[model samples]
Target chain A: MIKFSNVQLGYGGRPVLNALNFEIQKGDFFGIVGPNGAGKTTLLKAILGLLKPVKGEISFLNIKRGHKKRIGYVPQHASVDEIFPIKVLDMVLMGRYAKMGILKRPKKRDYTIAEEMLKNVGMEGMAEQNYRELSGGQKQRTLIARAMVGEPDTLILDEPVEGMDIQGEIAIMELIKNLHTEFTLTVILVSHDLNIMANYVKTLSIIHNNTLKLGPVDSILNEETMAKVYGAEVKIINISGQKVIISKIK
Target chain B: MNDFLINLEFFKYSIACLVLMALVCSFLSVYIVLKRIVFVSVAVTQISAAGIAIAFIAGLNPTLISLLFTFLGVAIFSIRFTERRLSNESRIGIAFVVSSAAAILLVSKSARGIHEIDDLLYGNILAATPFQIYLMIGIIACIFIVHFLFYKEFTAVTLDFEMARTSGIKARFWELMLYLTIGAAISIGMRTSGNLLITTFLIIPAANGLLIANRMKNVFIIAMTVGIISALTGFYLSYYFDLPTSPCIVATLFLILCLTLPFRFFYRKS
Candidate 1:
């Protein structure tokens, strides 16, 4: 579980998001929906401990002193160097670096876990393939494997389905869903996609206009909320318990 | 061939020195080429040369001043360019040009003649002293040791800086460390190898490795092999043909690069 208490985030003296208070429960599939420059990156950076909160504290509830929160992060874009000629399995195995001792190379156990994660992500056969050679979806899966190989308690994905085709989006989303269930992970997905947030996650958090709203999907999937958050004429309809939002520019 | 054999003993230290310089710079070339920060290499070397010129003008130690200037240059290069006003390439280009002008101006004003400029641009490798060889051995050893110890950290930061931070690694620190080591390697190599041959050692072999190998370890193997061959074979070719050593080495590397061009067109990425 993670808790943010009165967290104010920004660069310099300008506050991007102010007075944020929320708690993400364990095993919750959470989605954060925001437009560009909506302090989503700032909040994520705070969680990742890259940026310190300006005013308040964000704490991990149950993590012990010695064992910090192992957060598996899949970035918005492929951060792996395309020109490094790094192989698929080797890329995944790098996830163990934080846990490794100084001067340590990847052991057999690390490789085993990496390969198993590759298999879990359905990229077992591509382990030897160069990352530059992989398709977009395959690269995404490899990234997922890289994150999962660290055996993280929380998995944070930024714009997971961005730039993917319809099939890739669906496949990646389903893969993330299964991993969430099987691992009982606390998943935090950040995206600007309202419909995907409505359709997939159990609980959704919306950050807009320097404010944040946290609630269950049904509570947050109303037209008024969508209109206020997105600043547009919006309609929400449920198809067989799946929510879809239609937006029109005024 | 007979003359090459006769002079081999006399030039053994220089040969060993070139090979060592090539080894370290070639390894770093992977990161440089991978990150598309190839310009940083030339820029830092230029700045380091400026530092040496300053040392000659100010009557200070060249090694110390060179390292100071190299570190200063890398610090600027290490700054993450978030602002879109001037791109990283333009910024690095500015550093390159400014440092180049500074080196020339400083050398022009120094008591040492303009031929000192040539010495700075293309070092006298055949005149390398034992102290220089020992210093190179020490620096190369440190480079290799530190790199191996922090291989994952270095790779993680170079590959995905954001993800490295998220994974609890000090991404910024490692990034700065990487730039510093690269600057150090270039400066140390510049003492005898000069800017041209050092830059060649940094990019050519690594570029070839990128062309031929699909795995990171194999890429390093291929690069180190190419670098050593360039040093040894190029030295032989230089002696046999009575040509300049640096160009002979550079030309040999270029020929190898040309030989490896087909790999780039045909080699599979996956």
Candidate 2:
């Protein structure tokens, strides 16, 4: 479990998300929904320890000092250079670097775990293929496998389904959903896709105007709350027991 | 050919030194090209040259001074700049120009000004000594061992810097280690191989390998092979043709890279 108490996140001393207070419980499938420049990614960076909070504190309940390896992070797929000559299996093996320790190469067991994660993500056949050759969806899955290979208790995904087709999106979301249950991981996914988040996540956090609205999806995903957060007229309709969000043009 | 063959013993030390230098530079080249730090190499080389020129003027040991200056340059350039007004590339360009100017000025004031400049630019590898050869071999061996030990960390940082940091890999420390290693290599290599040849070795082999290789490991192996082959062939060609060793090696590397262009074309087509 992770807690952000009165946390202020920022760049160059300018607060992006001010006075943020939230707690993510174990085994929770949490989604963060926000518009462009709403500091969703900044919050994730703070959690990952890549950026320190400008003010206040972020504490992991059970994670000890120097044991921050309990959380696995999958940044946006665009964060990497596609042209770099890295193979899928090698990329996944990088996940074991922390556990393998410095100066020690990955062992047979590490490779097996990486392969199993790849298989879980439906990318076992492409392990030997060049990562650049993979499609956007496949690249996302490979990144997920890389994050999951360490067998962390929590997994953080940032825009995992961006730039993918609907089919690819559904496949990746379903894969994450299954991995959450199978691996018993506390999942925190950040995206702008309200419908997917509304249906897939039990609890959702909507970041707007440097504030957070956190609760169950059904309680926080209404049209009025979404319109206020997104600054657009929005509607949430139930289709086949799934919430579909549509934003009206001005 | 008979004259060259007769005096091959005199060329032995230079050949050994160049081949070892080539191996280290070529191996380091993969990271340089992939990380897009070619200009940093240029700046570091110029700084080392400036250090040598200053030593010449001050009557100090050139190797120690050059290493010190190169480490100074590395320290400056390796710092991650937060200011957006001056980008890293622009800063490196400024460093390159300033260092080159300083070298020229200092060399002009020295006793062997023009000769020293020529040696710094093109190198005098043909007159290398056994001590330099042994020193180069030792330094290169240490670099290779360190790289072998931290290979995964290097690859991870080069491939995805942010991900490596988030994964608790001490990305900055490893990156600094990489830059320092390159600094040491360039400084030592510049003593015998000269600026132009060392820079070429640091770039062309990796560029050639990246052109043809589909995997990272192959890229490294191909790069080292390209470097050694170029060094050996260039040494022979220079001996047979009565040309400069450094230029010949650089020319050979350039030609080899050009020859691999067709393979790249075919690769993209397939």
Report chain A TM-scores, every model.
Answer: 0.96, 0.96
Clashing pairs in 2: none
List model 1 lDDT by residue over B1-270, tens digit each: 777678778988888788888899889988888777888988999999999889888889887899999999999999875454678899999999998998899898767768778878887788777887898889888988889889888888888888888887888888899998998898876868888888888789888998888888888999888988998888888778878778888998999999999767776543
**lDDT per residue (tens digit) for residues B15-120 in model 2:** 8888888999999999999998999999999999999888888889888899999999988887886555678889999999999999999998777879889999
lDDT of 1: 0.85
List candidate 2 stretches off by more than 4 Å: A64-66, B239-243, B267-270
lDDT values of the candidates? 0.85, 0.89
lDDT over C-alpha atoms for residue A123 of model 1:
90
RMSD of each: 2.6, 2.2
Best by lDDT: 2
